[model samples]
Target: MNRIPLRAQALGARLAYALPRPLRRAIAGRPIRIDGQELALDAQLLITLQRLSGAGMVNETPEASRRKLEASERLVSGPPIEPVTVRGLVLGGVPARLYEPAGVGDDAPLLVFYHGGGWVVGSLDSHDNPCRFIAVNAHVKVLSVDYRLAPEHPFPAAVDDAVSAFRHAVAQAADLGVNPDLIAVGGDSAGGNLAAVVSHQQVLAGGPVPAFQLLFYPGTDGTTRRRSRDLFADGFFLTSDQMDWFMDHYMPEQDRRSDPRFSVLLAEDLSGMPPAYVATAGFDPLRDEGEAFADRLAASGVPVVKSRQADLIHGYINFLGVGTRFREALSEATGALRTGLALSGRKGADLNT
Candidate 1:
């Protein structure tokens, strides 16, 4: 549990945002311009503060890292979105949370969401706020999948759980008060990778597939390094060292990283996958690969809304508590989710409409 009281943290966040832009900019230092895109002031301030704290996920044991993130997020993410009922449930034996906002109908759309932590550290609690935000804002139920992590479970465990949970959600949609045809698969970072793999698995199996996919700065290709990986490799919250730590723990074998199960971007056939909204952060290390995945999807004739959040960084999805940029970026994705669900089953419908 978080050490600081949620109320105090929320208050502090409010006060931080209440500061004038000039002062905040000065305190955060000069604007970070990389690859021709400037970082948002809020993001820069947050990064600056994080650097000043001298604490980071790098070099920490997974257990300690998890605890630190859980505590730190409470101080920044404000409070969880409210009036959205959360309940525990099991989908295909995977523990999950169902976030259903008040006033939603029985046949509401459901996003089977995977929490991002590089396939290692995050949990349902770590991602509770994002799920709640999506549920309320998208006007849909969010099935936040608590899949097994890596280092202990590793590789295909998270992928298996993701696919199973999504399949079960579709199969049991009515019992879960959702529409089967409107079910989407989504996640951030590692979670996004799982969602993309699940979409491919379902389609390849010639069976049920996700109606849509919501990917946030997803790790699309793990085998090859891209320019963004080097450009934003350091000081952007998710650093190269941390990423190496995650990969080393999650998939120790470097050769296997290119497997389509882990690297969805390398999949031979991507056609027939569901419509997707892939959001990449301009300053994120995974930015180029995520955009590459979206480009592949589009080239394969899949309807894709590839959005580059030019001022944000990786993990912005979880920073919804204090900043406007994060919220603004997420709002666009959630709105697209709502619209995607509405247009899901129409055979020839324009998804980008």
Candidate 2:
């Protein structure tokens, strides 16, 4: 539990993974190979594991859980981009924050972001770093919604908030200094699920469609168990217990799982949705479902860019200092965003990545 032991363990993990192929095999036995590359746990993840060793699947009250997270969590991100003006405001009758990169003004692209905390613990602060990175890297304004949490405001509440917030962002584009048509929607984990559902809801209503959808390790189907659940039930960061708690609080009724709003693939039609950029971690329990959703989107004639970080686990975005793959993945996803928003060929100032 001491810092010395933690650092030592992290060093050991790093050295162990760096050993020559035969030596590593001789010492730690064979490593799992994914996409023909060794899938050994990285040192940054070793430190994270040490920090999370004592944590359980949050059974305390939501407030207590949130406090626990805020007190202990440490997310070391990439070098901060200078002059990123981050400000908080109320949009669509809900809490939200805006991340504005330099040189962007009215008619610039924007993204309405949602944070991932299993519909429970995340807040504007928890996702601030990623929003900053997205805005600066993709050269777009990011509006992050602090939507209502669950048990107090359960299923359909977050969905409603996302739709309202996205609509508000587009409608008030001039005031917010962004192009109404280039407004995109995105999020991680549960937030990603909400973003996908939000897109579907808008299409079903036949109005106010977003320009793009950026989903990272989203939960697409909750009604039925998939092979991924069995294979990745335990370990790999996001455990089964945590997921069970999130689902129970968000949707207590099993029947509701069948709804297209929850089980997105069950939707009769996925047509008319915006372009999508999907990212998934191979070690994650939700990996299969996320990829499945991407396939569905492409099949529905939606332009899709899929990136699979096979060696990394879930929530790598928050593990900024711990991995280089996170940066690589973020850059790729943002590149897709730039293309979708037509930012690559813009005549004026371009975002330096």
Candidate 3:
């Protein structure tokens, strides 16, 4: 809503990215090393810019946070990619967007994607760029769900919408030009949490399970505080204060933190869930929990790949529009999704287990 401030921030980002690494590092201040990992120069520079511009996720009200996220999206999201056509649609009465990359045939794999904002700030516009990137790069169709946010639709509202949208995608896959058997569920941060929960619920329901999962720095467990939560609690873009703010709005009742829908990591069984590629950012507070979830998936005989972008910070997926590292990291993710879906297709509907 406030273009002037966001314009200044975008200019700052462009200048920072243009500078040589040495100069960028100089401006970003001394190397920040914590938890045995050195901060990537790109991440450090963005953090510095954020601090200087006073732009962050935390705000006095959820409405303000939502507006800020929309504006800030332009600052970090790179120029839009072409050849990906997006169409508005409704899934099980929930608003959604379908991204179809050029050249992908009917029966292409589809990914049900949820946007991150700790379940409070992100929206269809805020995450449109990344969804396009994934569709174009992975050669897969993407259904980006605009799930209801919290403090307005708290607790299980988002969880319920996510499951419903995913089910609708499966039921209408043929009409939507996708292969139902090759569908995957994915998202970043809170969206990732929903994707993980969807996989669990589908499996437990005993049919029409997602064939794969692409989780990017997902918050898997809200019930336990891990070391990373304290270590990178500040200065890493996604601050501890912001996390608390999100949890307060989304799952206000502290007693419900252990619900499997909120904290999939605490679920009784990880068995029979879809194969997955779990990505974690080194400096993220949710790092440990995400990796722990991946470990459990592996232990339960689910095929899983845990990737730690050792120098990046949280929310890198949205940064793909600005920096090289962000694009590279996300490219790796899309490539994995491409490969995973291709493999899942080969295995046929048996993957629906």
Candidate 4:
């Protein structure tokens, strides 16, 4: 994996994020071609599909899904900067990985991330590159949590672990080398959902809430049949059947879906939550729910920035850290995190996704 070239990519990322939504949609709607692939398929997503095809799933067991996601993340990640300062430790009883860029200060802001995979598959390794990229580009510390998977530890188990991890990080701010005031909580897909739940729980408990929320295509209202769910249910990487499988294994009981912690969109009294930055893919089945959550947050008086990466599909952030257009999207996302958390530094590293 080659590190993304900084000079041109840094400028391109800025312009790509600055382009208006309609213009982005116009450019994305223009179909392009990848060698040995079908039309209209994003090149990065094609790479991901090729990698996933090699890790065939025998069953939906946690072990099988973890193997599958690890392949996808590994194949998608580009070469990172040499000798990155990555370390590992157990937060309380749950394991975690910390990605710190060289020369980070003790006052650097921190991002506590939960990996995606519907809360049943992803591990710290599955999201290692993204965390590294964010830490380097945004000049912040990124702590990726490895919470217990479902079916074995269902419902509130992941939630409990996430909340515990954040509290522990806060309590050990000096030892962890981060600014407690600038700490943020974020995740993608199921991980995003968990982060939102933690933010809400922290607010209600009258404890220190996260400074910001970074949600990527979060599964907010699982019970609602949003239009994107039906439109992109069949293709664009995540299918409705696949979601049903994840939800079934994670929750099983339909009644559990209504719990505010599980379906954050259903939560009452959304006031006093942390400010948020939400990024939703154009073709993801969870697009509507993620957007709805952003709207809900804004309506509740929280500062919010809602961005739609209209050219990409779900999980494009896993791109091998290169100068591909997909990596530019991830760069834009890190920019948002940097601004939201006020991670002060020279911001344009243009690292791989």
Index of the highest-lDDT prediction? 3
lDDT of 2 by residue, 1-353 (tens): 33435345445444555567576446533455544544544523433453544432264677776764543334233345556998888887988998999988777888899988888877887777788888988899999999999979898898888888988887788889887777889999988998999999999988788888989899889877777777767766677778888888888898888788878877888988888999998777888889999999999998888878777667767655444556677788888888878842342235422
- Which 10-residue window of candidate 3 scores lowest in summed lDDT? 1-10
TM-score of 2: 0.85
Spell out the clash pairs found in candidate 2. Answer: none
CA lDDT, candidate 1, residue 30: 92
The candidate, 3 or 4, that scores higher on TM-score is 3
TM-score of 3: 0.97
lDDT of 4: 0.77
Colliding pairs, model 3 = 78-321
RMSD of each: 2.8, 5.0, 2.0, 8.7
Local accuracy of candidate 4 as per-residue lDDT tens digits, 187-220: 9899999999999999989978998898888988
The best-first sequence of candidates by lDDT reads 3, 1, 4, 2
| Candidate 3 residue lDDT tens string, 204-305 | 899689989999999999889899999998889998889999999999899989999999999999899999999999999999999999999999999999
**Per-prediction TM-score:** 0.95, 0.85, 0.97, 0.83
| lDDT scores in order | 0.88, 0.76, 0.91, 0.77
TM-score of 1: 0.95
